[model samples]
Target: MVEDGHFWTETNWVFIEVETDEGVVGVGEANWTVFRARTVVQALEDMERFAVGLNPFDVETLRQRMYNGNHFLHTPGVVQSMVIGAIEMACWDIMGKVTGQPVYNLLGGKVNDRIRSYTYMHYKWMPPEPPEKAAEAARHYVDKGFTAVKLDPVRPKEGPRNPRIDELEYAEAAVAAVREEVGNEADILIGTHGQLYTHSARRLAARLEPYDPLWFEEPVPPENFGELREVVDSTSIPVSTGERLLTVHQMAQAVENGVRIIQPNVGLTGLLEARKMAGIAQAHYAQVAPWMYAGPIAGAASVHLCAAIPNYLLQESLEGWNGFHNDILEDGLEWDNGDLIPPEKPGLGVEFDRSVLESYAGEYRPESS
Candidate 1:
């Protein structure tokens, strides 16, 4: 039940419990933005006809049937994919429990020692103040042994822009200071937040090229592929994007449009389709750098995806302090230097402390409520 009113921005989840005749109950979660929660739940109810009595171990068949049965929903993107995704993850979890192996082991074993990670700066509350201060904070992350970082150099401090060059200087100064502190050694990611016009995006990408960032992300937004193509064409620096994007078709478009780095969110992209998207990226010779914006479960799920794929470049991470991340998970993923031991349990391989979620689940403010 939704303890709050409706799932919007709150930390709400739609968990699926698959009960068997033998009394085995497998659980999985499809956590999305408040708006999409109902979509996923509806998809689950509609798709249950093929799932209820089927052998959960026949995961491939079940997945194919779900895709094929609901071809219309599955084709466009994660709306239906998430419904199947929750089942897919739960099936894997059950299989792992039955076979006594880790989920990564089931997905063709691990490829790397650990999933390398990067933390994001300028994420809402932590807006860009100044370059020197941003640099100092980045150094603090490095001191904590993180090897990579991501920053959004541009933000509308007051409100929406009116085609003005308003925070432009602040943006440049912030990126410059970050570069100064990291000193070209750290793997820095400069995100434009897709806020610039086409020409402005090109100019901003050129300006940050000297810093040698890991990749310039979402420079021109996702709506206009032509704009994205223009920015990519003008810059020698690599471009990373696609958090707002979900399907293979969109990623195929991004790759065909010449994006060098692909950043799909596993929570939104679904687990198996994300792998498929990576394969498409491989055909274009683009590296995959999946984005992370959720709590530990999503992080663990993303890491599992990264482990199986050959083209994974890096995964996004946040350098945890006390209060910011402490309430999010039961136990933090083990981060050694800059890598997390991909949850080896079953399915997503981790669970959140429900009590913590309950504590953080605040009031609902929807009109119906």
Candidate 2:
């Protein structure tokens, strides 16, 4: 794990590097938990026994062994999925390196040359900031060529429950402000972070419908698909979910219920599983917009996945992949206008700058002597 103070909080990026006997080293990221980086590192350690002797090309077997092999702890949660996902990602990287092809080619070849992206509004303009300030933030990204921007206008002070009248009013005003500023030049995405009850989510969606958001993301908590279906039924705006979902089964359930847009996190779901999820979404006419909140390695994996999936919608970018993201990668992800150009190089098409990675290395460097 590496500590980096570049984001809103002092965050730790948990990365996995798998090296084969041929001296091919492939890297992946597993920084899924909010503040439990070390816990993920320990879990990866425990699961290492399953991957030590596996062939990099047998990605499915590796996933099954790590997942089903652990009879005692095989419930399939975020931490476990993230561990298996990271290792599976590295194995793909190894496979790509061995074959002299990019990961996308191995998946199914590119269906998109460039992936469209969207980012959250600046942190300073988060809720409690007036509607005008939120409009200013929206204009900032639109001016920079982003076709879409996301914001969670309604923030529940406590736990997940129904929102207050004033909270709904502020959210409506915020979305209206952003719409007036950017006009039709950009799509406004409403993200609630699954903080509302089903009824509140419907109410919030009703308020923002006039503004015409691209989607209402995770309006209600992800645990209950029945509630999600209720929110979907209640809203005219498209309801999207799946960043918190741990496996393809959960994603299938969400799409089967009524969600037309699936936002699977490649970092947590693994590339192969995400592909499977995308297939599931495609069968039901749903779209895949790979969610990203971790470091660049996972972002790189998302790029490859997006490039290959026919039902891909949009990708989440951390302010156009600038700052430490560019610093850590040998060649930062290429961002032009509002799109990310998939790298043509082998493996993930990007490599870590060892000097920068060493500088950020924190308490959990398992391979460090």
**Which candidate should be chosen as best, given TM-score against the real structure?**
2
- Span of 10 residues, lowest total lDDT, candidate 1: 1-10
Local lDDT at 102 for model 1: 64
Structural similarity to truth (TM-score) of each candidate:
0.84, 0.96
Off by over 4 Å in 1: 1-11, 23-25, 35-43, 68-78, 123-128, 156-163, 321-332, 352-368
* Superposed model 2: Cα runs more than 4 Å off: 1-6, 365-369
- Cα lDDT tens digits, model 2, 222-314, are 999998999888879999999999889999999999999999999999999999999999999999998988789999999999999999999
lDDT of 1 at 286: 95
Instruction: TM-score for candidate 2, please give it.
Output: 0.96
**lDDT: which candidate is best?**
2
Give the Å error, residue 350, model 2: 1.0
Q: In terms of TM-score, how similar is model 1 to the real structure?
A: 0.84
Q: Which residue pairs overlap in candidate 1's backbone?
A: 7-34, 8-34, 118-317
lDDT of each: 0.71, 0.89
Q: Cα-based RMSD of the predictions, in order?
A: 4.7, 2.8
